[model samples]
Structure formats: C-alpha cells, structure tokens
Target: MKPHKLPFENRWSNGEHGWQWHCELERLGLMNVRAMFADHETRHPGKRAVIFDIPGGFVRDWLAFHDRRTARQQFLWRAIVIGLTLVTAVGTVLNLLRL
Candidate 1:
C-alpha cells in the first residue's frame, strides 16, 4: 500500500461486478497514523481492518456531516433521474395521442 492511501481508497478488495466491499489494515512501519484498540487475534484470523478508536465527538460530528452531504447528493441524482423519466413518459404519451 502506498504511504498516503486512505483506508477506503485503492486498497479495497473487489466484490461482485468489481464493487469494493471490504479492505484490510496492517500495522506496518513507524508511521504518523495510529491504530487504537486493535485486536491482533481477530486481525490475523479474520483479516479485518484494524479498528481506529477515534474520539466520540469527532465520530459524531464528522459522520453526521458526511451522512447529510451524501444524502443531498443522492437526492440530487434521484431528482435528475426522475425528471428525465417524467419527460420521457410525457413525450411518449403525447406521441400516442397524436397517433
């Protein structure tokens, strides 16, 4: 893994249709990052990512903001898709009326 790659970046494993569903973590080298509350037993056996015990306040605030941002983006995309579909449906109905 490159030194600067984030946890959910290119290190993810490809699932069905090349979708990334999981990633692994390792305690490699002396680094600036820290892995807190890591279960070595589970890490080796399950090959799971090491848990990062981020502060509660950071998790609450950051995750809440991220969720809201993602929700807004999803809503925008859905609105665009629905608008296009409605336009297509109306056009089809108008064409049928002219037949």
Candidate 2:
C-alpha cells in the first residue's frame, strides 16, 4: 500500500490474471472497468463471440466499479459521523457555560 495508491489501485491486481499482467492492468487504473472490457474485445478479436455470450468478464468489471463506489460511500459516511460528533461536543460545551 504505497501512500499515494488509491484503495482500488491496491486491490486491482489481487484478482485472477492481475498480478501476471500488472503493468497492463495499471494502465487501466484510471479507466472505468467497462471500457477496459470493451477494449479487450478489440485486442482479442475472435474472442468477442464467446465474451458476449457469457459476459462474465463484464460482470467482473462491474463488480470492481461497484466495490470502489461502495468504499467511497463508506468514507463519506465516516466523515459525516466525525463531523456530527464534533458539532455535538461543541454545542454541549456552549450550553454548559450558558447555564
């Protein structure tokens, strides 16, 4: 976990075929996972027919995007919780001094 590595960037290579082709995978770090799968169809030409038939690869990409989204949502929730706690603490002190 490098200091600058985003969470998804860290987990991106933990999946199948990820570690073996880490460089190529890293190139896709900024792309929406769906775009990567669509581009794969071009690189592997004949593989398209089978890929469209099953769509497992596309599903994997969606899952990655969804997981990343969920992580972001959790982070926001945590921030909100901390903010509310601080506000409550300040308000409590202010109320006590006025009494």
Candidate 3:
C-alpha cells in the first residue's frame, strides 16, 4: 500500500532518533513506504537540522496489523537466536570434555 504524506516537515536534532521515528511512522503506515529524511535550515537560519515528513493515520487498521505481525516476527527471531546460542554453547562444552 502507498504511504500517506504529511504537509509539513518535522524537525529533529538527532539523526538516529529521527530515522527511528520515521521507521515507526512507516511501520504505522503514516509515512511513505520508505523512511526518508532531508537536511534543512532551522529557524535560527544558520543551524542545520534533519526533517522528516509527519505521517498521517490514513490506514489505522493496516498499521495495527503490521505492528502485530512485526512484533510476532521479532519474538520468533529472538527465540531462534537464543536457541541457536544455547545449542552452540552446549556443543562447545561437549567437544571440550571429549578432548
């Protein structure tokens, strides 16, 4: 689905947090399909800042569904990673004992 765009740009000081906010907005179906930001001059004239389009809640249901799906996937991946780590640790210990 296409993302909805906001009329104005939202300014942020920290790029990482700004990007994360954009990602969350995209995940919530508020922004474009991709999270993007642009550099802009702040009201202070000389100060530079990053700006991202504010997201609109056009697809609330879709956003909710996506969030749930993402959460489930994240949980599954964490479980898999933990299980693999445990298996690897056990194998390493067994090999050490045999040697």
Candidate 4:
C-alpha cells in the first residue's frame, strides 16, 4: 500500500486552522463547530489544533449547536424508550392473563 501525505504536511505546519469551507456555515449560524471538533476528535485525535486549540468563541458556538442537536436526540430517545416500555408492559399483562 502506498502511503499518502497528511492534509497538513507542507503548508499548514505553522499556520492557523483551515476550516474556511465552514466559514459560510458559521455565518449562517447553522454549523455545529463543536460537532465538527468532535468528529475530528473521533476521526483524528492527535493532530495539532484540529479540535482543542480553536478560538474560544468558535468553540463556544460549536458547543451551543451541539447542545441543541443533543436535545433533539434526547427527545427522540425518550419517545423510543416510552414506546418500548409500553410494549413490554402489554406483553407482560397478556402473559399473566394466560397463566
């Protein structure tokens, strides 16, 4: 297998973060920079300032978006949990009646 050059080999060694493509998303206030950082953490943890060393304000914005997304996920999870609980309760009642 041929080895590939890392994304930050020559140019960004001594430069700032290069998440310009996400600038538009940031401007729109729809981009979750924290989720972006989390993705980087999960995918490429030990690579310079890909996640941790970003500006505090940018990180904050990302975190806010992440929180919002997480809330939505929590709502969905609660719905699923309630549905399962009801199903189990009904099944148990049916079995007890048969016994």
Model number with the top TM-score? 1
Query: Model 4 over residues 1-99: C-alpha lDDT tens digits?
Result: 443332222233222333542343356454455557667768866665543455434454455655677798999999999999999999999999999
Give per-residue CA lDDT, model 2, range 1-99, as digits (tens). 322322344333344444334333444553544575666566764563322342434435544756789799999999999999999999999999999
- C-alpha lDDT score of every prediction, in listed order: 0.42, 0.54, 0.49, 0.56
lDDT of 2 at 73: 100
In the range 1-99, model 1's lDDT, one tens digit per residue, is 323323232322223311211121123311212223223333443434333433323223333444576799999999999999999999999999999
Residue 56, candidate 1: alpha-carbon lDDT: 29
Tell me the lDDT of model 4 at 67.
69
TM-score of 4: 0.41
State how far residue 50 of model 1 sits from its true place (Å). 12
Q: Output the lDDT of residue 70, model 2.
A: 76
Residue 41 of model 4, lDDT score: 68
Candidate 1 deviates by what RMSD?
12.6
List runs of model 1 lying over 4 Å from the truth: 1-54
Off by over 4 Å in 3: 1-58
- Tell me, by lDDT, which candidate is best: 4
Candidate 3, lDDT over the whole model: 0.49
Provide the lDDT at 9 for model 1: 26
Q: Between the candidate structures 3 and 4, which one is better when assessed by TM-score?
A: 3
- Predicted candidate 3 versus true structure: per-residue lDDT over 1-99, tens digit per residue: 444443223433235544455456556543443232212222322433222343322223334545677799999999999999999999999999999
